[model samples]
Target: MGEGIPMTNSTDVRQADAAHGREMDPRLFREVMGGFASGIVVVAGMVADEPVGLTCQSFTSLSMDPPLIAFCPALSSVTWRRIRPTGAFCVNVLAAEQRDVSGLFGQRRDDKFEQVPWRRGVSGAPLLDGAAAHIECEIAEIHPGGDHEIVVGRVVALTGDAERMPLLYHRGRYGVLAP
Candidate 1:
């Protein structure tokens, strides 16, 4: 357990001025973002004695001094609704061979954890087995995005395995780094 961030009513929507007047097609935006490779993670948390999580690729380290990390989850995420009250979560950095795990959590099924192996972390979050690394964190802040919410977490505990190879996603496929 670590310091928890206070939950807001979510009525205050953060808006910003448009970057440019040029309009871009939604499909082209998705295609451009897909071309950029990113690491994937399964952000899991336990609430009411149940595991809740969803596959995430829009996660990244935000700060080092405060030990913060950020992940973007869709505004209508069912899994987020289930775990929001917990105020804590674990980021399981997927290894190269955990493609099946990714597929299992990518769906909107309630029994997502039925076959997954994991244990609770220090922050009461579920740490997935065989993950390349684990980062336990407390919810710090949340900002409203276009269609997703940017969740910032303050890291409490973390560990990694140097031998494990991370999985990457690019252009709609999973891949491993070349030797």
Candidate 2:
């Protein structure tokens, strides 16, 4: 576990900012945010009949009444643009033992799915073979966020294994929850 951040008043924050001669450091902001553990997922889709995906840690369930979920993709992600036009995607919740798959999808490579075995979902998105869970969704809304886009998806299909542990990311490394 990571250490908790000390509570700071607005005045103290302002003083620290003044001392640093900057509003907030991007590196510090990322490091602080990384302290929070997040489940690792691969947001994948078929673009022109080719499998496209990217490792993402910014995934979460937004609503249950309407079956909504969301994930953030970086502004500069090429894979995101490819998947965006597909109108649907699959959120593949990676299993804890699939860190290598996550690392492969995270990179810019011609064949990310060369070794990844997957099948098409009902939404036409690639459903990874060993994912802890799979959420097929149609693109519902997209909102512009700083340095990333908040992509909301309306769940159309879902499947999972309760016994499978999910892969996690925290403080710039991968981890798995204890049973």
Candidate 3:
């Protein structure tokens, strides 16, 4: 029931059949979406006494009544593979000073936690130190997205520091809030 309207200079609307039924190029889609600024977070979990985590940009609070949050993980993420079986995860909301932490978790490496400082949360997931905040959760639901999985988590704990500035990403670069 949704179709694009003609661009009559009234507002910026493109036709649904733009480029004659050809799908949007992946590169262009990525470039367009990169214009959107997003906060960075690390979704961490414990696996056999080992900590596993991955950087996620797509995370949001889903509900207030039930206290739910959601994060998207790529289909091929090895960290997600390990986290899914644990039944619990912690979201470490990165502070502006944690760009190095985000870069570490965003990669594929066996010693991801070698230099990281963390402690176990009630959910058994590693809670990164120096984060702006932390949300401890238990897995509640899993849904499929085009190239990622939508993981819904039921919030079990919440903690934050208002003085810390959040780390943000936009156009392939890290940013901080304006003063």
Best by TM-score: 2
lDDT of model 2 at residue 157? 100
58: Cα error in model 3, Å? 0.6
Write the residue-wise lDDT of candidate 2 on 105-132 in tens digits: 9999979888899999999899999999
- As for model 2, its CA RMSD to the true structure in angstroms is 3.7
Better of 2 and 3 by TM-score: 2
* TM-score against native, each model: 0.87, 0.90, 0.89
The local lDDT score (0 to 100) that residue 7 gets in candidate 2 is 45
Give candidate 3 misplaced runs (Cα > 4 Å).
1-21
Candidate 1 lDDT over 1-179, as tens digits, reads 99854423431111111234445555656765798899999999998988989999999999999999999999888898777778999999999999999999889898878788898898989999999999999999999999999999999999999899999999999999997
lDDT of each: 0.88, 0.93, 0.91
For residues 1-179, what per-residue lDDT tens digits would candidate 3 score against the true structure?
88853334422222233456755556656766787899999999999989999999999999998999999999999899998988999999999999999999999998988878999988888999999999999999999998999999999998999999999999999999997
Question: Largest lDDT belongs to which candidate?
Answer: 2
Candidate 1 residue 156 Cα shift, in angstroms, is 0.5
